[model samples]
Target: MNVRFEKLYEETKAAVMRYVSAHCYSITDIDDLFQDTYLAVYKSMQSLTEPIQSSEAYVIGVAKKVLARHYSAVRRLRAQIDVSLDRRSGRGLAEETADSVDVEKLAGDRELLDEIFELVTVMPVTVQRAFYMHYVLEMSFAEVGNELDLSEAAVRQRVARALTEIRRLYKRREQL
Candidate 1:
């Protein structure tokens, strides 16, 4: 191990472990996150150009990225499962249309998609991510949970809130 990295690990390991533990959903995830955090931090430290005020904070930021990437992969896996199940069940586009508004029309309208994009941009970041994951990425609420590290219910609520806001905005715009 590099001397500086060894020193950093000695200084920050306990606090980092606490953070990873608090954020992790599983014991396996805890180990993976911790190791990935240090590896990222080590690479970052090697290439660092400017000074960071806190080593622990920087390492924690890298940990956050690792967690995000991990969750992204999980979401992809969930989406794949969702797709396979849909295929096996013979659920087609019309079936999906019955559950929600047909995004197909909006998807075909570049102008409408652009307008909705702008509307979503102003919403809270959490809602935006959930909305994008569920609608744009074509993930179910359960898969959206993987992206946000939230419960399926929680991601559903976020997307619902975004939809409510978009409906309100569209109604108001129509009266103009």
Candidate 2:
């Protein structure tokens, strides 16, 4: 700590703390942010091309930058977490649609399960792969997409369509 720079830091530290406290909503982040702001200020202070007129004002600028970076990172992490959750939950689209179909019937009737499996085998190749990977193998839509070289949306659509087709076929059989 240069004696001149140390003097300036002492003068501005309180004002910088207040500025950081004012901008931040979370108490847990405040101390860490306060530390980061001063670390930046110290680095800037080291590169003294010319003396700053108002050291307090200069430190406040550094604190603002730190706060901006913190919030930007927090936003990015939040978005990634949201996207991950949406993708996983979206994988259940077929299951939700299948819920409309009577799975309990298949559970009690082995012959009906066999018939449904046959119907699934005769479905379009894309639909069959999507349905089998997702339902039979219990794979997530994203995993099915990777296995079938399709997008997650495409995989979800195929599985859903397969379920719809099976329902139609099962109803036709019931009528007969």
Candidate 3:
């Protein structure tokens, strides 16, 4: 809309897209992350201080935070699903103990393996959507906000909260 915003968009869009792509795996995910990043930038443009010379740096910082949050939430949900599956399988106590240990080990491996999609589906609708846009789709925070009608900061916060929940889930799994 404004000249400054337009200029900012043109100058940083590719960098932002690359940033998102580095964190994601798919073309669709890349597009989503790119959009989210820009949408976040758009919403926060008004609050930025003057002489903000490094737009790319700031946007990348935001993108990192967003990616961390998304991954965290997905990890948490995965932990929960693993736990639930463990319970439903109704293995004996000794078997359960062995299974639990195996599951914890599995979780660690899953994290390394980047089996995120399996866990991403368990989040709440809004969270999942945001998660998909930012992580799976690789949309930037701003892009996520624009598609979902939220602020970039709000998207960042959502992803962060999701990560927190996920960490809690993993900790619980490890303890069990």
Predictions ranked by lDDT, top down? 2, 1, 3
Q: Which ten residues in a row have the lowest lDDT in candidate 2?
A: 81-90
What is the C-alpha lDDT profile of model 2 across 24-141, one tens digit per residue? 5343355788899878878877787888898888888888888888889766476342223332232333322333555565567666676666565555556765665566456789
User: What's the lDDT for candidate 1?
Assistant: 0.64
Cα error, candidate 1, residue 62 (Å): 0.9
lDDT of 1 by residue, 66-102 (tens): 8788779766476342212322232121222223444
Each model's total of backbone clashes? 0, 0, 24
Query: What lDDT tens digits, residue by residue, belong to model 3 across residues 1-176?
Result: 47887887788777676566545533334565667677777778878766557978988877776666555777546534332453323222222222223444656566533433444444455566778667755788998888667899998898887665544444444555
**Comparing candidate 2 with candidate 3, which one achieves the higher TM-score?**
2
Better lDDT candidate (2, 3): 2
TM-score of each: 0.42, 0.42, 0.40
> After superposition, which runs of candidate 3 have C-alpha atoms over 4 Å from their true positions?
74-176
Clashing pairs in 1: none
